[model samples]
Target: MTQQHGKKIMIVTAPANGKRFCGETNYYEQLLTAVANSGGKGYVFPLDKNPMDRKGFYWDAPNRRWVAAFCPIPDIVYNRYPFKIRENKLACKRFFQWLDDQHIPCFNTAFFDKLTIATLLKNDAVLSAHAPLTEQLRSLEQLRRRLKKYPVVFLKDIHGAQGRGIWKVVRKGKSYQLHSQRKVFPSLTFPALSCLLQPVIKQRTLLIQQGIRSLKTADGVYDFRVLMMKEKKHWQCIGTGIRLAAHGGFTTHVKYGGKAASTNAALLRPPQAVVAFIGRHVGRLLDASYPHIREFSMDMVMDRNRQLWIVDINSKPMSFDENIIQQKRIRKLVNIFLKQGV
Candidate 1:
C-alpha cells in the first residue's frame, strides 16, 4: 500500500464495462480532480473488483486508462454505487462490511427505501410535521381504503427512482384517473382498486401517500433540490436548485424531462432560511439514524400555504454541478478527508 499524496480517496461506483465512461464517470472525474487540486489523490472503482485481501483496481488518470496497482487503501470512501448494482450483488454487502471493519469513513453508506424513510420521519416529532400522510399498501383493499381518505394520492414503489414506477391517482367524480409521465388512464371505473394496480404493483410493495400540489410555473410543477454536507461534524446546506417538471409531466425529475436551474433569490418564497431549517433537521435525523452518513440530497416541496414537505432523501445523491462543487461545502468535505490521516 502506497500513499502518493497526503490521502487517497476512493469512490465506489458501478463498473462501466464497454463504454469510455459511464454516466457517473464524469462525476467521479470531477471528484478526483477536486481531490487532486486540493493536494490529495482520488480514484473510482467498482465493488466487484475491490478485493478484501489486497488493493483493488482503480482508474489510472495520467495514463488515461484502467490499471492494476497495489495502491493503498483509501483514507476515505464516497459511495456512489447505483441502487440496481448494489441490490443485485452480494459483493456490495461484503464491501460495506469490509469498510466497517477497516474503519474507513464513508458517506452515503446505503440506499434508502422510500417507505423506510417515510416511516422514520413519521416517528419523529419535528420531522413528522413536514411528512405527508403515508401508508404502505399491502393489498387491493388497503389501496381502496386509502383512496377514500385523499382526493388525490400517489402510488410509489418503495425502491423506485428517476420518476419511474410512480402513479398519480386522482378521484374524478365517480371514477378514478391514473396519470404517469408518458400516459394517462382515464375513467378507471374498475370493480376494485386491485384490478387496476395489481399488474402495476406486480410483486412490488407500494407506498400510498397524500399527493402534494407543489408550486408550479408555466413549465410545470417545481421543487427544490437541496444539497447538504457535513462540515466538521455538523450538517449544513450547501446549494439549492429549482427543478421544473417537463411539459405535461407530473413529477419534477431531471431525467424525466425536468429542467433544473439555479435557484433565483427573487423567486424564493419561503426564504432560504426556512429551507435550510428543513434541510438541517432532516440531515440530523438521517445522521443519527444511519451512522457514517456525512452527506444527503433532499427533495423538498412547498405547498401554496408555504409549508415545507420533504419528499425524498437520497443517500447516494447525484453529483452536483461544478458551481456547487466550488462552494465551501466541498472544501470542508475534502478537509475532513485530509484530516483523517493516511
Candidate 2:
C-alpha cells in the first residue's frame, strides 16, 4: 500500500482531563501514532476547545476555532467523544446531531441516535432477528409475569452504558430477589437492588430482557466483544476480544470491574457457526444502522445449544487496542480521507 502524501485525518474527542472523564485510554493517542507512522498528519480537536476559535486552514489553538487545513474538508472526521447516555445526555445528543448535520464524510451517523435505536427495537423483525428479545415494563406485576417465563431477566436503562444501571432479577421460592441472576452466580441484598432500580426508573425508559446464560470461566462469566469494521466495500473482522467479569459477577462490562483478554483465550472460544452467524447479522445491522456508519463493536453470546445472540450493539465503543491486529483497517480509514484529494 503506497502512502498518500497530503491527505490528513481529523479527530474530534472529549477532553482527557475533564471531570466526567470517560474511563478508558484514549484511542486517539494510538491513532496519532498510526498516522505518524503512515506518513500522514493527524489533527486532533479536543471537545473542550471552542469551535468559534479559528485561524487559517488549520485550527488556531490559540484562538480556539477550526482552521481550514490546506487540505479538502478533512478527508475524514472521527467522532469519539465520551458520553454517558444516562448522564449529561441532552448535551451529548446535541453535539452528535451537530456533527451529523455538518454533512462531512463521517461514521456512526445520527441514524442510531438515542430515540431511533429504541424505536427500531420495537419492530418484530428487527427484534426477532437482531436484538435480544426485550420489553419495557413499569410495574412489579408486569415484571413478575415476565420473570415466570424466563429464568433470568435483566433490567436496563434504554440509554445506559458502561453497565452502570443494570439489574438481574430472578425468582427464589415464594419471593423474588434481585441477584446476579445469570446461572445463579450470587445475590445482592434486597435493599441494594431497590437502590439500583429506583434511579433507573426515574430515567423513564426502563427495559427488561431475557438473559442469555453466559459462558463460565475461571475468572468469572464472560462474553465476546467482536470488532466489526467497514473497509472500502467490504465488512471485515478486524479483531475480537473478551471481557470477563470478576468472580461471581453477572455483567461483564469493562467499566464495572471487568478485565480484557484476547478473543482466542482458553474460555473465550465459541463454535464456528456462532461466530459466523454474528458476523452475518451484525454486518446487516450495521448496514441498516447507516449507509455511512463505518465501525462499531458488537457484544455477543453463545447459548448452551450454540445459538448466538447479540446482547448489545455499541456505535462508539472503547477502541484502545483493536487497531493492532488489523492495522490495515486503520490504514483503509485513513485512505478514505486521502482519496478525497485534499
Tell me each candidate's TM-score.
Answer: 0.88, 0.75
Task: Return the TM-score for candidate 1, rounded to 2 decimals.
Answer: 0.88
The pairs that clash in candidate 1 are none
Instruction: Give the per-residue lDDT of model 1 (tens digit) for 1-342.
Output: 334366888776665678532446655555566677777877666555454544444555666556555547878887777765354467777877888898877876778767778988999988898899887877776767777877788988877877877888888777888887678888887465447678877777788888887777776688887888777677788877777778888888777787776545345455778778878888787776787777778888888888888888888767665365445555766676666431
Across residues 115-185, which tens digit of lDDT does each residue of candidate 2 receive? 34544554636345545667776776666677677777888766667786577886665455675334343
Query: Best by lDDT, which number?
Result: 1
Q: Stretches of candidate 2 above 4 Å error?
A: 1-3, 16-26, 54-73, 84-103, 110-130, 179-199, 262-264, 272-274, 320-329, 340-342
Clashes (backbone N, CA, C under 3 Å), per candidate, total 0, 9
In model 1, which regions exceed 4 Å deviation? 1-5, 20-23, 49-71, 84-88, 262-268, 325-329, 340-342
TM-score of 2: 0.75
What is the lDDT of every predicted structure here? 0.73, 0.59
Once all C-alphas are superposed, what RMSD does model 1 give against the true structure? 3.1
